[model samples]
Target: MSILLWQIEQHLENHLACRFGHLNYCSLRLLQEKDMVQGLLKLQESEKTCSGCAIGKSHRSSFDKEIAWRASQPLELIHSDTCGPMQSITLGGNRYFLTFIDDHTRMCWVFFLQHKSQAFNIFKRFKNMVELQSGYQIKKLRSDRGGEYTSLEFSKFCEEMGLERQLTIAYSPQQNGVAERKNHTVMEMARTMMHEKKIPLKFWA
Candidate 1:
């Protein structure tokens, strides 16, 4: 026990607020055998209840598993998401913005729509634009299992083109975290830009 006293001293010095106290007979003897003399001495001063220790030692919920996608060229795999029904509607009665993001280039396209139903047509326009410019058909499409993505027209169009529709499991946004996070980031950036520039928030459409 005496030989390991230095190690106990080193450990206790850094985490002073956290100390083991009121050890059972077995634990105390075990510590003694390990030469944890410093910790033993400090334990006398430690309060029975420690807020810092409780907060630091509390268990946290595990994070969901993340999806890994191999990098692809522009128009190869597009992430589509919608953000909307903003509290403050635009003058044009726009309530939402459909976003199309290229997986490889990270370039984004925004289309303002008054209803969620417009997502399908907006996707069509995005497809045409990407195909014309990049000369590549989208080989894969990824989105959450939103009603918009499951629409018959959208599914049929994707099937006919031999495109793989990768819909995340219902209610699991983390599975499509890239697009979900992009929507959040864009909203934050748009808010900051409006605040800094003194532009009307409704123009975010």
Candidate 2:
């Protein structure tokens, strides 16, 4: 049998701290007190400060409540987001829901899915139904750089359709605020309705 050497001292303090999401001083100290990592307390030396933790934990100002631009026509732009792994499953066995909002009309459509992988296919289905009904070709799509939106298949499909993509900055959901707020509003409404009617959460979809 081979034995592993933790070599806690050989590793840099910042690296270890980052591994546990840049844990705070108390957290690190607790680890030492619990002997989770023997000698880990040495890294807490005054000289070994974590810069990443300082930067990452820094607070940013709030986003503007109003959007600077709005689509001039229906389907000019679509804001989409996937929300879930709900606390309870839907009637169709779905635990997730994806939403697409028309930027100009503020119209929102939702689709349920059992897995996140179904998101791309649901987008295609939504595109087909809406384009057929509205007779307006979607010019752009906006979403976070979720794997469902960034997958090779999704990118290729958008390219083939000549659709523009707007991705949010890393860790910034405010860039996709429309979809985020829509989901928030929807959740609040659903919860309020369930409370009023004594409906179960499984009907959230």
Candidate 3:
């Protein structure tokens, strides 16, 4: 019985010394209260830095306040993004999809594609359809620095059409928040609907 108690004490002491010694006493106490660690009584102050603790506690700076996009007219500005090479192929054999969002109306258009190369053609079709319907041509398109939007053919088409291309910086999705948020909403809604209707995974085209 004494040996068992001694083993427990050693384990607890080692845990404090090696694992969670970097944390202050209050945090250690809280962790003990939550039963995250067994037999933690207190933390001893030490000069040594805990590499794991330093990494775990480090955080990136918060993003700057968002500047909302305000368009005066439909098709004046459009935000676009492409999502997935999904894990499962859809019934239509499409593995990827693209989305376009109008900044003014918040209207969205979705197109399914089997390859990324299809994005430029899809955008052309979308532009014609929306312009014909609304009698307003697209002025500016804002999207991430995707190869589909940066291709020579895509750039030439935009130039000929007098459409301004606004590409977000690499690795910056927040700069294209409208389309990103719309895509997220669409995905979540689709997931919920599929769950409620018990729709098969293949039908999620």
Best by lDDT: 2
lDDT of 2 by residue, 51-137 (tens): 443443444334446647999999999999998889999888999889999999889998889999999999999999999999999
- Clash counts for the predictions, in order: 1, 0, 0
Alpha-carbon RMSD of each model: 15.9, 18.7, 15.2
Residue-by-residue lDDT tens digits, candidate 1, 27-120:
4445666886654543332223334323332332333546676555777788888887797889899988778778888777878889898888
Off by over 4 Å in 3: 1-65
Rate residue 22 of model 3 by lDDT.
Answer: 40
Q: Which segments of candidate 1 are over 4 A away from where they belong? A: 1-67
Compared with the true structure, what per-residue lDDT tens digits does model 3 show for residues 64-153? 446875999999999999988877789778988899999898788999999999999999999989999999989999999888889999
Highest TM-score against the true fold, candidate: 2
lDDT of 3 at 193: 46
The lDDT values for all models are 0.69, 0.78, 0.76
lDDT for 160 (candidate 3) = 97
Error of 3 at 18 (Å): 52
Per-model TM-score, in order, reads 0.65, 0.68, 0.67
TM-score result, candidate 2 = 0.68
- TM-score of model 1 vs. true structure: 0.65
